[model samples]
Target: MARNFAHGNYSHTQKKARNTGRTARDQTRRTLSQNFMVDRHAVDLMVKAAAPEGLVLEPGSGEGALTLALAEAGARVVGYEIDPRLAGQLAARTRNDPRIDVIRGDFTAARAPREPFAVVGNIPYSVTSKIVDWCLRAPDLTSATLLTQREYARKRAGDYGRWSLVTVESWPWFSWRLGDTIGRESFRPVPSVDSAILLLRRRPEPLIRGRRSYQELVELGFGGVGGSVRASLRTRYQGVDAALAAAGVPRDAVVGYVHPDQWITLWERLCG
Candidate 1:
C-alpha cells in the first residue's frame, strides 16, 4: 500500500514493493518508467559530476537517490516521477529540507523553466532523447548530466564518429562528454543494458554563432545525400566543392572524418 507523505511530515518506513506479487515482472503503467538505482558508488559519481549549485532538474526521480544526492551537493532540486508510491517516498524523504520539490507526472509534458538551471537525471530510457531535446532547448539551461544507455551516451559524445541530429544541432552550444559506466546490477530491477553518464556543458560562446541554417546543413549532410561529405554538400548547394577545398577537407573524405571545424568553415562559405 502507498503511504501518504503529503502533509509535510517526513518519516522513515520500510520500502514498498512496486506491485502485488502477481505479475511483478510485467510492465505496469504505460506512462511511468521506473528504475530505482541501487548502487551508492554510481550515485556518488553522478553527484560529484553534477557538483550542482543553483537549481537542478531531475526526471524519473524514482525513490530520491539522485534528487537527495543533488540537494545534499548544494542544488535546489525539482524532480518528476510518475509513480505515486515512489513519489510519496521521495516527498517524505525530502519534505523537511527546503532544497527539494517533488512533482508526480510526466516531465516531458511540463512547462520547462526559464531561469538558469542545471539538470541531472537517472532518466527513463524511453524518454532519453526527449529529455536531451528539452535540456538543449531550455532557454536558461547551464549544464546537463544524464544517465542513459551506453550506446546513447556514446552517440551523443560522437564516440564512433556517428552523431544524431540533436547531437549535431546542439554541438555549437553544448560540449558532450561520455562518463563512467553504471552496470546493469546498479538498478533494483537490473535492466538488460548498462547505463552511463552524459555530461553536457554549454559553451561560453558557440564555436560558431547559433544559426538556423546549421539545422538545414546537418540534414543535408547526414540525411543520405551521399556517403562522403564532399558529395553530400556539393550536390545540395553551389560551390560546395570549392568550399570543401578551402576548409581543407578532402573531396572523398567520409562525413565521419569531417570535423566540427570543417562544418563551421563550410557553413560560413555556403550559408553565411
Candidate 2:
C-alpha cells in the first residue's frame, strides 16, 4: 500500500520534474548549437538566396528540411550531418530521392568536389567560422549561402561599413553580401540571436594578380602599426601616400574603414 502525498507537495514535485526535463532538452540543443530553421518562409528565402543548381553541399542538414527544399529547387544536394540519429532519419527519408545524398560526418573534414558546386545550409553557429573557412578554401566552389548569426553576416558582408580582415583578404575571389534576416522565432528552440543569410559568390576572374603578394600587402595594411592604415602601409611599401590618394583612402582612415575595392586600387598603385 502506497501513502498519498499532499496535493500541494505532489504539484510542486511534478513542476520540478517538468522543469528539469525542459532544462535538459534546452541544454542538449545548446550544446549541439542546433537551432534548426522551422519556418517555411525562411527556408524559401534561403533557397532563393542560394539559387542552388547543379551540385550543392549543405552543412548541418537537420531533419532534411533545407535538404529537401534544395532538392525541390532542382539542386543535387550532398548534405552532411554529424548527429547520427538525425543523419539516419534524413537518409531514410530521402532514400527514394535521387537528388539528395545524406552523409553522416563532419562537414569540415569533407573534401571539396572536383566539379563546381554551391554550399547552402543553416549551419551550426558554433562552427560557423570553420564552415566558412572550408567554403573559402574550396577550389571548385561557385557560391555559398549560409544562415549565420546576424552579427556574423553583417560583419562578413561589411554591412556595418567596417570590413573584417578575412573579408578584406577574400574580397578578390569572393563577393560577400548580407541577405534576408530570419527572426529568432523562426527556429525551433529559438536561438538567443536572430539569423541572417550570408551570400558569397566567387568572381569569374580574380580582381588582382599575385594572390600571395596581395594578401601580404593587405596584412601589412591591417597591422595597425602606426595607427592609421596609411601609416601602417607606409612601413613596408614606398609611395603609400600616392597609393592612398589613388585609392581614395583618407589619410587618417583605419584599415576597417577602407573598402575592398580601394584595397585593390592601392595594390595596383603601389605594387602593380
Candidate 3:
C-alpha cells in the first residue's frame, strides 16, 4: 500500500495484514531537504534559459519534470539522479528520446562528461553552494540554470548587496540572474520555504590567472586566512588599492569590482 504526503502533511495508508502502516522505503520521502518545485512556469523558465542547445546536463533530476521539458526542447540531455526509483522512472520517460541519457548516481561525485555541456536542475538546497563550486570548477561547462533557495539566489546574483563568494568567483566566467520564485503550495509535500531559480553561463576563457590569485583575493575579502589570504587589502589600498598598485592597475579604479580579466591585469602586474 502507498502512503500520501500532501500539502506539507504526512499521512499513511490503512494498515493491512502484517502491514506496519509506514510508506515503503522507496516511496518514503528522503531527507534530501526541500524538494519544492511543482510549477510548470518555473520549469519553463529554466528550459528557456538553457535554450536546448547542444549537450545539456541536469543534476538532481527529480521526477523528470524538467528533464522532459529539456528533451522536448531538442537538446541532447543527460540527467543524473541519486534516487534509484526516480532515476528509473526518468529513464523510462525519456528512453525513446535518444538524445536523453539518465544516470543514477551522486552528481557531486560524478565525473563531468568529456564533451562540452550546459547544466540545468533544481538543486538540493543543503548542498547548493557545493554544486555551484562544482559548476565553477568544471572546465568544459558552458552554462547552468539551477533552482535554489531564494536567499542563495540573491547572493549568487549579487543583487544590490556586497558580492558573495559565488558572485565574485563566477563573475568573469558566468553571469547570474535570479528568476521567479516557486511557492510552497506547488510541491507534493510542500516545504517550509520557497525556492528561486538562478541562471549561470560559463566564460570562454580564464578571467584572471596567477595560479590562485582570484581565489586567494576572494578568500581575503571574505575574512578567510590560509597564507595571508584572508587579510583584506581593502584597508591597505583604501579599497582595491593594494591589488591595483601591485598590478600596476593603470587607472585609479578598484580591482574588487572590476571584471575578472581586468583584475587579472592587476594580478599579473602585482603578483608576477
Give the local distance difference test score of model 3. 0.66
Candidate 1 per-residue C-alpha lDDT over 3-60 given as tens digits, one digit per residue, 9 for 90 to 100 = 2223331222233345566243244422345567898999998998888999898888
What root-mean-square deviation over C-alphas does model 1 reach?
A: 5.5
Candidate 2 wrongly placed segments (more than 4 Å): 1-26
- In terms of lDDT, the poorest run of 10 residues in model 2 is 1-10
lDDT of 2 by residue, 1-272 (tens): 11111122212212222346466445555556888888999999998999989999999888888999999999999898776557778888888888998887778888899999999999999999999999999999999999999999999999999999999999999999999999999999788999999999999999988799889999998898989998898888899988888989999998899999999998898888
Q: Weakest 10 consecutive residues, lDDT, candidate 1?
A: 4-13
Estimate every model's Cα lDDT from 0 to 1.
0.79, 0.87, 0.66
Off by over 4 Å in 3: 1-28, 34-36, 224-231, 234-269
In candidate 1, stretches whose alpha carbon ends up further than 4 angstroms from where it belongs are: 1-26, 29-31
Pick by TM-score: which candidate is best? 2
Best-performing candidate as measured by lDDT: 2
Clashing pairs in 1: none
Ranking of all predicted structures according to lDDT, beginning with the best and ending with the worst: 2, 1, 3
